[model samples]
Target: MVWKPDWVASKDILRRMGWSVVETTMMNSNPPEIEVPLGNFVKMNILFWNCRGALNVDFKRRIFEMVINHHPSIMVITETRVGGDRAARIIEDLPFDGSIVTETIGYAGSLWLLWKTDDVDVMLLSSFEQEIHATVKVHNSDPIWLISTIYARPRLSERRILWDSLKAVAQLHNLPWLMLGDFNEVLSSEDKFGGNQVSLNRTLQFKECSDVCNMLDLGFTGSKYTWTNRRPIFDLILERIDRYFANPSWRILFPEAAMTHLPRTCSNHCPILVELLGSTPPGPNKPFCFHTMWLLHPGFPNIVQEAWTEDGDLQGAILEFVSKAKHWNYNVFGNLFAKKKRVLARINGAQKSLASRPSEFLLTLEKQLIEEYFFNFTPGRGILGTEVKIECSYVWRP
Candidate 1:
């Protein structure tokens, strides 16, 4: 239980403000003494991949690469195309300590939910041919959430069954629910390229199901397309069928949760890594520096006005305003630094895609992101820095 002087002061302040603090054990500490809010202190990584087939000779190596790089507490591999003793043997050699397997239907959809028992407790709730639902409780944490790993069947008729099953599961409990996998269906035309346009009729069922379940798409960080058909330039087909969706409850639980589309290797579908960072170590405390961007928020004036008191204690009023303004900036206007990081990530992903394929859509997206970065981060600068333009690629200088 390492306690800093500042943390001690914070604990006293929180207790005085009627906030409950608990000495919960975190993954980083052996016998935890850190006092945090009375809730889950989760900070774990999850990796989901549609491995297409897991029987290849180098499959174990690929899994090792992902595990070594991401160190995920939970991992889901869909479309294994293997079952029975063969599947068990494959999982046996993997890095995780616990595992659950949903056998394939004659070389079709299968799901392997693997987890580190040392880091998390996963209770198998339901397992179907196309999906595996589990209650995940991070070790030494009070939060318990439901996680569903799905692999919707390739055919439209079969996918309807998957959607219906999910709806039924969604009704079981109102816990923070997270569903992720290869849906084998696109939600919009923007989710695909070099293929027949995705018609509304094709997307209507999935959209309806999502709306009924109140699911929000947890946007990804890397290339928009997650799967590709390995073909020549003229016939190449790409689609972002694999994704993560969470209910509003789950989003509120982990607002900083983000998913990254990893580079495609050993499979057509790119691996998606989801990060839930809840118990990260606090940074150094610095004097408050007012941000110019807060002026852009419509609610800033209201927050200042509310913080101002009728009493003639100028020091107290200034302190109150600072506290209220910081809270508003966080909960309403959002953390500008975090937003800037996401924007830069999107820009990097777009630039990478353009470097490989040079698509008009990606080029335009990169240009827009560049303008946003310059306008928000650079003081006294125009949106495009200085006359930004896109020829075959984006050209900008600050």
Candidate 2:
């Protein structure tokens, strides 16, 4: 039989899980500003994805989620399989301000650069069968970057042609240059696992290509391997075919840049993120908010009554109320935000545990915590959004 639970039961379940629904806050009397939006400026996130032509309905949604979560300034995609009329639609769905795409020849391979729609002035220098070369200047920052993305031809002879052409392209401009994509080759043996040993001759060719281009290996931080054959463990193959390489000038421009291989949940190849951090300027202070959720507790009224006794005037009374409200919250509530953090941590632990042993009880607990997390994601919504219609009822004594 399926189990159903109401909010009351869910609350009891949460309490049993060690996180009570009636959480309180130990707030500051001076009302410290909310420390949100840790980063002041929007740093550039460069993402390269070899999607391998799986542009299902969820494909676009997944892309949107990645974009929203990481806010990449420049996004590069390969093997999109979308062509002609459909390519435009795909670009439209991207959160980035604009994009440039390479031609798709019968759904074989395609390359494109997507950038923030505004303050992005990029000129397409050249486009080829295997690559697209462009110069990008964000907000006239003077540190212009020449970017080239390649989806190399699978054949060895054809790859030689691509390497030679790329060598010529790299020397075309003296600016900071970044080269990235699915080269379909490995530079080192460590790049492959569960596969036949990579040939010395193949690695030599790839190394020689990098030498000719003066490209620095912007090594990755996440999964050691970026591509998998999707076969069973015994017959499985994994290799780091996708890579990000840049010239010395590029490193000089963004010294703290890093590339991380994000987990591959739905694709053969994992998407790599190249983070180019920028100077973060100071942001303005956040305004104070009055949380009506506090009022739900019986002590809230007592604290307000004690703090609201008229001072010299209305302004003084309000000042006193604000001061005591903060003090009372600190003394009485015992840190509400900390409670949220603990609840989220418990939820994470429950999720990991459920993976090993699935149970209806754990599922219900996870669902409850998820709801709790969302509520905390947007604090004090009880008094914020119009969804909460507040009504004041008057009791008449006759």
Candidate 3:
């Protein structure tokens, strides 16, 4: 006997699965400024999926479950395979505050971009048949980046147009940019496990386009293949077609950013997650080491001189200098290492919240923390970690 679950039973099943339905709250047009406390990181989660069909009951259930469990700030669904009033009905049932649906061409292709305005501000920049471009600004954060959610055509010749169009978009802006969804093309032979080997010419063409656009694939964890034909073993094919790519600037802005492949349930394409600062693993604590950048500060010499004059012997004076220098570093230049640690701790906290339902306020808080880290630690200095050893002490490279 085939059994079906009702609304309450469905909720019970979700609760048993360790997910709870989050209550929706109305947000004010002008909310109060969010205070970003040390060690409190907000979460920024973007989910992408190509759900083959949108009107199916299974699709609706899976999408709802994902939203309640993952709490993504933004979501993009491709290959919806339905449009017009039919698409509107499914979209109305979605949990997001806002949505943009690109009408499909007679059951062929459609794209849906949905977001919650309380935590994020998404401004539509432009839209094409195969792609939708937008500017996403996480609330309480200053960094404004570009997002291109795509679903390229299956035909090789048609895909060429996609590559050119994407390249054109890249040229039009200098903003930190990210692209996600199914490109329907593999980068290399390693990305394909079965079926006819990917053509070398196609790979090179894609590579050339990426090089011109200065976009690099954001590497992923979990299953290597993201799409499957699901045919018999003798005729099965698997490929890593869906992915996330970002420019160097975006990568630097979210240094701890990561991508995860979710299990394929309601679709042939595995859902993908882009996390700005994923969970951080704890590590051994390091002893306090003096930074050479302190020397660059105008007040460093005065602090050392003042501390040295009040001391008795050479040993006493050296100890006094260390203490005074530390005090000065904290009060004046700000203890960057301590700040970094706090930011990382907050990022870990936000990542942990991903398993449960997080409020929109928490999402804004996460973005605020990320912006603080980016501006504080690496402003003007290319990227963060560069150190060398000298007499049992580590110092930043000039």
Candidate 4:
């Protein structure tokens, strides 16, 4: 497909908004790779989404925004619907620089990769004698081999083919390997949701596959199943087919890695978000802070107090006080700079109103402002609120 000017503009806008857009490249060519300086730590996040069909333009745009917002380093997509010439064009449109491997027919394909940075290399290995597989190498770290989506038919023979394909990749890579995506085979009775009986033969086959590959199953603890067949027939419904298995080496590389289910949109299977760490210092966890006490100074108290007496606006008086407390530079605080400026602007406006207010009222307003600011800056008990104070150099996509 021809690259439209509008599409290029849109892609640029998306990148500015923090989406990694793929550059144009020849079909079937490896994504470009650049040497990443050796670092103490490197963190990479990979997002896996099936995309259902992605044929709808609106849905495709939403997917683009979602990836941009999350800002993963590498994205593995399954079930990409673009076919033949359209497939090449779709890959061209992706915000990241990467490659695509689609099924003979558009929507049935197992896997595709969209890589953002030049620090990583990708090699598409032989298509599974019956499945899909690829090898990815990250500069300055051990290589990671990936196997794509695997679908199993109801017949045991077909499931055997899927298992055999997995073993083949494990044997070929010989290094750290991560086999993820839809496995289509439930490993145990616990893997399914209620009312469905898992087949003993299927469970045995899955265990055998794991044993032969020397894999560790990262099972779902919260959600019992990954797939749901609405049919009433017991034989027709099976679940928990989507999973990630890795060898000890890969496990050490990502000790905290686990699957998180994304909200179900157009697809029956939920997308998985995976985080990989390579000796990288964890990024800052706490939101930026602007100290209110820093704004209160002996010399500035009189000016702010005078403004409070003239302007009755309490928030404005506090902002006026903070503006004069210039010792606290917003630029030093990184993410908190914008918020500080906004608060300062609002306070300046309030100072005019406070200039007419009584001294007592102004004092109370200042105290209240300090209290509110402190409360807002306090760390809370949650993922976003947790404080991360570690100091280390690391490279991350975000």
Candidate 5:
């Protein structure tokens, strides 16, 4: 929910009055466009890390708290060295209602999905190349084709197999899809800070994978890379191997979503934070006034009292005052509240326009607003201290 200055004042007042306003911001302005109402727009956090085989109690608790603080609608983790059973035990202890784990022994297996059961509807259709890919339906929305994780092999031939598997899944679902995780292969030279010496085979394999999936590579945000090697000369050397890909649909909800490189934990690679725009909520009707400060005028009380004496109702009195008030500003507040009604009508019309469009388009517009307007809308930046970053597409190529 967008926090306005008035809302902050209201919150402060409520706190002073000893009222606990647990929910300060509403999730969405209007209901989901689907036939049924999904409680609200879901908030999700996709985390990618190579957790170097350590899952202590303290570590588990810290991770749990981190997830809770973010309050993601869905969560996905990668490079979990632990087997599925052990991962399940850790996840089971958390507050989330459901989790799906897929693990392979030693070399390159990963955990795919861990989501809140109440918000998502899961239908296990078929496995893709023995990977745990699923067709998931979100509340009151169309199904989202999802694959938990992808572990690209070091060898070109093996990577080709993985690519084919992904293609098979895409053909099977034939819907909007997002396949994400520790891909382990950098697509271009820009992906790695200083890895020009590394063989081009892996990069070529990554390009092939992208081509087969018909995917657009959304690059990382904060840091140049996620993975790191130990050699001092190349000590801080990092590579943007971990990534995410979306078909047309997933991009709708999050056109601006990008990977943020987080501080490293027990893993060699820093965790990646994929951020998306939250949905807007329908707002209350704008307040009406005959003049900006009409209520503060000394003559208003007597006029209101006389109107009430005649009409015996608050609304009727207000109507009478509007009709009788001399030199009233129609532009600010019309005699018939027609302007207020028109504003409300405009809001309704915008909502209808949003609802009729495809979910992807609506989501893209929302992302543009957040990145361009909302996130950058800082005080002291623009009018009312809000600024919007207008440029739409930004890319760093190698």
Candidate 6:
């Protein structure tokens, strides 16, 4: 096998620090070193994950890191395996304003629906054998959506009860609804790989269940196979049993919303991040800036030359140049500067806040923000007089 000393020592430390065999698999490889654009989004972040279990100390730490990175407004975790007794121990530790957890079934499964109360108003609607149903009023606005985080019963015989109960619940509620979880069944043959052929009847049953509930597949980004048996080579079995489905009505509410499968490390199932674009609230206005494309437009230099000659004093000429630039920029090309200034302003504000009153919470948030800003920095190439590290580098989309 591999005998890298650095890797061995790292694994040894994690094992000593209470990490399980599976959780350390994260250190074995980094996420594919390629950039994929998941269009920018904010507000109403929902992360659905089947953590297998959150009992291990190292896994719990990883969960905290995921929360801070995604900044999800609502998070639903399934197969948590946290019993009623242990629920009290973990609920308060989660970085959310409120949470609802269904009673665990001996050792098989559990469900937790956590939300940032500041971002949404969540009310419990029903709690069945394997699901926790709730209504979330995002931003406390109209047209609330029903959300259910379910842990499907493992056996074929018990799945009907789970399906029927959910269908009955859906029939009772007319609101737009979204359901996502590990149903323990695949949608079709294409959803499974290297697993003794998934039976046709099984796929039909799942499709019928979803059809009865009027649920349709929402598209996603990232690895298609979401759940794996974690076995090596020939013994491994993979499936797309974990997914998100929503009715047409829900689509109408958040048309621009998208789901992306984030990098998976500590869990067998990848975490799905939902960007509810329709729910994103407004932010402060962007400042003005010059666009390089303006140079290509006809008569651009003439306008600048006229403005510069009209001024009597050197200071007046400089002021004239800026004012004329703003007018032309706004009327023609639009402002292009957005990244660096925003990053610097946030870094400054976070520092001042920490200085005024130091706290662990502020410190952690600031650290993550700083890391993200530097990670996004694009080194400028053209234009000799530009700042050493400019953020307004133009990228050709085509």
Among these predicted structures, which one has the highest lDDT? 1
Which stretches of candidate 6 lie above 4 Å from their native place? 1-42, 278-398
Q: For residues 211-248, write the lDDT of model 5, one tens digit per residue.
A: 77777666654445566563333233556777777755
lDDT of 3 at 229: 75
Please give the clash total of every predicted structure, in order: 0, 5, 2, 24, 7, 0
Error of 6 at 29 (Å): 59
Off by over 4 Å in 2: 1-42, 278-398
Clashing pairs in 3: 42-365, 42-366
Q: Could you give candidate 3's per-residue lDDT for residues 1-398 as a string of tens digits?
A: 11122334434443443223110110122223322122223468899999998876567656765775466899999999987888888888877887877878777999999999998998776677788888787887766678889999899998899899887666544567898989999999888766887899998988888888899899987667788775544565778899899987778677678898875544778789887869555347533456555665677779777766543766566666667866887787666566666775675465334213335554456456666655554425422321112322332122
Q: Where does candidate 5 stray beyond 4 Å?
A: 1-42, 54-58, 126-130, 154-157, 234-236, 256-258, 278-398
- Write down the TM-score for model 6: 0.60
Error of 5 at 107 (Å): 7.3
Model 3 compared with the native: what TM-score? 0.60
Estimate, for each residue in 212-273, the C-alpha lDDT of model 1 and write its tens digit.
78899999777778887755446668888999999877787778888888756457788999
Would you give me the overall lDDT of model 6?
Answer: 0.66
How would you encode candidate 2's per-residue C-alpha lDDT over 118-197 as one tens digit per residue?
Answer: 75666666677788777777674655567888899788997888888877654433456899999999998877766688
Q: What TM-score against the true fold does each predicted structure earn?
A: 0.63, 0.61, 0.60, 0.55, 0.54, 0.60
The full ranking of all candidates by TM-score, starting with the best, is 1, 2, 3, 6, 4, 5
What value does the lDDT take at residue 132 in candidate 5? 52
Model 6 worst lDDT window (10 residues): 382-391
Best by TM-score: 1
* lDDT at residue 314 of model 6 (Cα atoms): 56
lDDT of 1: 0.73
Error of 3 at 321 (Å): 61
lDDT of each: 0.73, 0.66, 0.70, 0.51, 0.51, 0.66
